[model samples]
Target: MKETTGFREKVVIITGASSGIGKAVSLQLASEGACVSLAARNAERLQEIAQECNQLGGSAIAIPTDIADQQQCRNLITKTVEKFGRIDMLVNNAGFTVVDKFEDLQTLELFQRVMNVNFNGAVQCTYFALPHLKNTHGRIVNISSLGGIVPFPGNASYAASKAAMTGFSDSLRLELQDDQVSVTMIYPGAVVTKFQEHRLDKDGQVRGSDGGSLYTEDMMTADECAEIIIEAAKQRKREVVMKPGKISRWIKLISPSLLDKIIIERVKKIIEREAQESK
Candidate 1:
């Protein structure tokens, strides 16, 4: 996707802007002339990214936010409009995984947490930004995952949350079609990000893993992921699926039953490894 030089003077609100894909997109958009508002829970990380944007001769502000809270989500949009006078784009990118065997996972609690941040958070942000987005005919880019489209074992909660976002994006897109507001859903395969380690437990403690690796070996970098997301937003594409792996996409389409079998086998292996390490 060509970087349009027209992003100049536009105001963009990005959740999960403290690091990874969100931070990369914030930097890219800001450098391309958009005034960016970076929203995330980690104040220090947010400050670091904001400083980088400012140093790059771009305008930006770090707004520490816990997107799970509806009030905070509302406040984020309000402050962005107050600071920039309008919101031209919103990137709902705050999310993490709770990848564990269904039997080992605290189903209800984990499901709620994932849904609150991945689905409810996006809803709240979009709801609050609707007026501004409507006024500007702006765009909404939601970061979902391949798991949302193709089910995977050991990621039931995360997959469910992303699927909810996908469905919500579709419905919302139709509702806003007459208003000229575009909603784009991004489905990325595996990307090297802090998502797996940042997943929260029922007590809010982040799940830790030795060496911290969960993505498949062929995972793309966060920059690549952000670039695709930017294009989807700019082109106002209905959906963007990146790293369309041959075997993966084929498995999803050609034989979903086979895909489920493969997922179950891998998940069983993962469970076995976890069990051995715990002992």
Candidate 2:
């Protein structure tokens, strides 16, 4: 992919940089000459990605961090500042989900865990990065989901957490308008990634391949999603809804009942298929 010149020499911190969209974004930014700080729970993977970024013609550092922990989140920011001096952008992309009905066993735990990582983690990182971002007139690119706006079944926790993130980003954008710190929210539909393989099941166990085909043929690629995010950051776009057209968003806003009916039918089919597979 061709590198964008806008991010040249910028300092960027990306959480969940070990794999998927976060990893793709880090590589794209690095290729564009940005100094990337890679943060994730997997230290080894982070280091590997950092090495790759360094070879990509830009600087990078590996900061092993579990965003769910407040102290670790603080450390991530401190380490980034220590290395880069200031933050030009912060990508809060660290999150996970559980695939099961709302009434499934251990659903509460799943919900809490999802919230801690998806919502609380982002909040903590943003709180620490704000001061530096304000200094650089920086940007915050949050990787939210389409589920946040139009939720589907079997992933209540994921949808709720993303919805909360969208709300938080919107409010923060308003508050920071005068500060020159831009906030961009990305609502991705479905992307081809290992996210489903790592998601939790009804028993709070890592969902294996038995979960069946979670991604559809129409899903976006991680690199494609990353490119959109990089562009949004460069242009300071307020929001992006990843869809072929604006009809889905318009329908949701204009006739929510109709949208809900569509979602309900699709979800019912998925649930029924899962039930059949289990038997």
Give the best candidate by lDDT: 2
Clashes of each: 0, 0
Instruction: List, residue by residue over 1-279, the lDDT tens digit for candidate 2.
Output: 112338888999999999999999999999999999999999999999999999999899999999999999999999999998999999999988987789875537778989999999999999999999999988999999887887778888999999999889999999998998889999887888878778987788897776437677778999999999999888888888888325667987899889889888888887787687778
Quantify how close model 1 is to the true structure by its C-alpha RMSD in Å: 2.9
Residue 12 in model 1: shift from native, Å?
0.6
Model 2 misplacement above 4 A: 1-5, 210-212, 271-279
lDDT scores of the candidates, listed in order: 0.84, 0.89
TM-score (C-alpha) between model 1 and the true structure: 0.89
